[model samples]
Target: MNVRGVIAGLLFLPITILLSIAVCLARPFSRLAWPSKVMQLWANSVFWMSGIKLQVVGEEHLTAGKPAIYMANHASMIDIPILVAVLPGHVRFLFKHTLMYVPFLGQAMMLLGMIPINRTNRTKSVESLRKAGERIRSGIDVIIFPEGTRTKTGEMLPFKNGGFLMAIQEGFDIVPVTIHNSREVCGRNSIVTRKGVCRVTIHPRYETTGFTVADRRQIMSDVERIIGSAVQLRGRDNAAPVIELGHH
Candidate 1:
């Protein structure tokens, strides 16, 4: 672990927590139009503190006020902040149910309208996803990690069907996103940070309104291919070696 990275973490961690508390307190009366702004401020702080930088491509692909399912491959914990910081629109994240019980932050998450799923129980997971879809239909865009969990190796994982299913059921478009170099910066299961650049590419939306249950597998497969191709292209363009850094 880099000693400077450690120092940066120590310095930024408390400030992040304090900001989270402030955001939590503001969640009760009205929607935090600036939640993403707060998140961007935090992400920029973390980046500056850790000596990491972000280069985003395809900003023109994102349309304002349009609710679409933003699906991305998970590489590192940093992915969340990066997405929250760069992705436009109000994003309601679909996270594990366990996150909803994490002290003060959890209460704030609930108030902010994050959907939590009990993945252990299939029935409950589906129900939770349905509710999430409803929220999307009601005007909030949802961000989901179709890979379901972070990859330790940085390789793309087999995307779960849940995200696509919700898109099909709710008549929403799927915006495939590829995040590059996060694993190299901060690999899964390690706290150490490496100086590097993380790139996020937002592909144009793939419509799902006409798809049916029989097309579920195909939809997921297509999403996987889109992400894989985007990642590969970014690596080639950046002159980085192509390796599956995601954990199996």
Candidate 2:
């Protein structure tokens, strides 16, 4: 890991936490509106400070006032911020169970109603998915990195079935999100940074209306194929409008 990268990350941690707190406190009254704007502010700041540029495409596929499961490929630390900043609606995150215990950040996450699932334990994982499915039924959009962890190489990893299983069981639509070049910019295993362009392609959504638990593997494979093809098509397309993040 780069010493400068570590120091830079540490310097930004407090500001990020403060932003999280502010969003949490304002969430009750503003609901998704204020919180979503604040989140974009923080995300944009992180990317700008890191000297990364964002190009997000296919946002028109996202239907306003509708809930869908956004299953994105995980490759770098910046992927979360890119998605949070670019996605049109208010989206909740599915975090690891252990993250729920992290200091003030954890409390703020709870206030935001982020879902945490224990992947190592079957019973707990199922229960967590059930809760998440209920939230989807209630019209809350949730973002899940189906890969479960980041890929060392930029290539997509085999996705875990948990998120697909939940989407199928709840009959929610699955949005296949492909993130291109983020791993090259800031890899998950290393904090070392590079100034480069990263793109997020939101592919057409897959409906799970008639899917069952038995179709989990198939559903996962279909989404993977869609994202993989899209990722391969990434380029410096000046035609696609870049999502601009305002200074915090």
Candidate 3:
């Protein structure tokens, strides 16, 4: 284990625990306002302790008070904190159901109103997706990593289609977000963080207002293409984006 990473982890553990407890306790009164700020502070502490730098683009695509599904490619664990810090408003995660039972974190997530996607079986998964739809309809934006889990090889994984199914069914818009070089900071199956820059590009929103289930695969494929084009899986570069859009 790297001494620097271990030290960073030790420093952040107590802060994390305290912040989680604070969220669980304060959420009932403040709803999401205070808890959201605490989440940002917790995320900022992680980046500061690990010496992680972030460069973001296309934030203008997100509009205030508009509920949408923010879909992104999952490359590393750092992607979670990055979204929590960078994205505006009260954005909740679409995490796996098992995470909802993880001690303090579980209680905090429950109080903070983060929806859990139960992927145990088809019947249960559909029910969970319906629950997510209710959250979106309530005027809260949800950030979903289309690739259900972090990529083990830094390569983009095939999306699980649950987010898309929810989007089309509920007539919510979809925003494609691309994150590059996140793996260099904290890769899968590792808690160690390396000093590196993570580039994020939030693409224009993809509308799903009148989409049918038949159009799900096409929409999914398009989002996958948009996010995958920005990063190189094999040749990792943690400085700047190699593929730049018109303005970025």
Candidate 4:
């Protein structure tokens, strides 16, 4: 474990939590403007303290004032903060239900109107997505990591159908987002953070207007392929060639 990183994270956690509470209290119930700005600050602070360098690409693909579901690949716990730092405009996450009980952080997240999915219960999951759809219709953008959990091996995981199907059912477009080398910074199930550049690539949005519920599998595959290929390309590009120096 990176003791210094753990210490840094511990020192910053409460500050961000307090900032979150203060911002939420000021905004009151998901007012995107002030809250989004606060989140941006918080994300930036966390990344700075953790020494995580973020390199964002393809942000031009995102259109202003267009509500879309951002489907991203998950590899690290820090992915949320990285997205918060890089993604433009207002955005909320489709997070797991258990995170809703996390003390002050939970209250802040609720105030931000983050949707929680109960994967174990079909009924609740559907209801959650229904609410998410309503939010998207209301012009709030939502981000979902369809991988459902962080990848342990830094390779793409098979995506769950829930998020993609929800986008299709609600007629929301899907933005395929590829987050490269996140695991090198902070891997799944580990809190030790390393200093490195985390690359975020935002692909053009995929419209779901023509897709039916039956197309969920294909939709998932397409998104996975896009993200996986981008990640692989980035890995290859980042791989350093070994050079040997002869004695002079």
Model 2 deviation from the true structure expressed as Cα RMSD, one decimal place: 2.9
Candidate 1: tens digits of C-alpha lDDT, residues 1-248: 56655666565546566767766676664464656556656666666667766767777889877789999988886777678767766787887788677655466556556788887899999998988878777777889998888886667877888888888877789999999888888767444577777888888889988899789999998889988887755544454322212110
Candidate 1, poorest ten consecutive residues by summed lDDT? 239-248
TM-score of decoy 2 = 0.87
- Compute the lDDT of residue 88 as modeled in candidate 2: 74
In candidate 2, which residue pairs get closer than 3 Å at backbone N, Cα or C atoms, i.e. clash?
A: none
lDDT, residue 91, candidate 3? 84
| List of clashing residue pairs for candidate 4 | none
lDDT of each: 0.75, 0.78, 0.78, 0.78
**Per-residue alpha-carbon lDDT of model 2 for 1-248, expressed as tens digits?**
44444554665557667887887678678766776677777777777666677777887888877789998888887787888887877777888778678776577667667788889999998988888887777667889988777887678888889988888766789999988888887868554567777888888889999888998888888999998887767555568876545543
Q: Give the distance in Å from residue 10's predicted Cα in candidate 1 to where it truly belongs.
A: 2.8
Query: What's the C-alpha lDDT at position 162 in model 2?
Result: 90
- For every candidate in turn, the CA RMSD to the true structure comes to 5.4, 2.9, 4.5, 6.5
Candidate 2 residue 204 Cα shift, in angstroms, is: 0.6
lDDT tens digits, residue span 129-209, model 3: 887778778766888988888888888888988889889888899999988888877877555788766788878999998
Q: Clash pairs of candidate 1?
A: 151-247, 152-247, 153-245, 153-246, 153-247, 154-245, 154-246, 155-244, 155-245, 155-246
Candidate 4 local lDDT, 1-248, one digit each (tens): 55646765676558657777767577755466787877777777666666667666786888878889998999887888888877788888998888789776677677666888999999999998989888788777889999887887788788889988888877888999998888888868565687777778889988889999999888888888988878866554333321111110
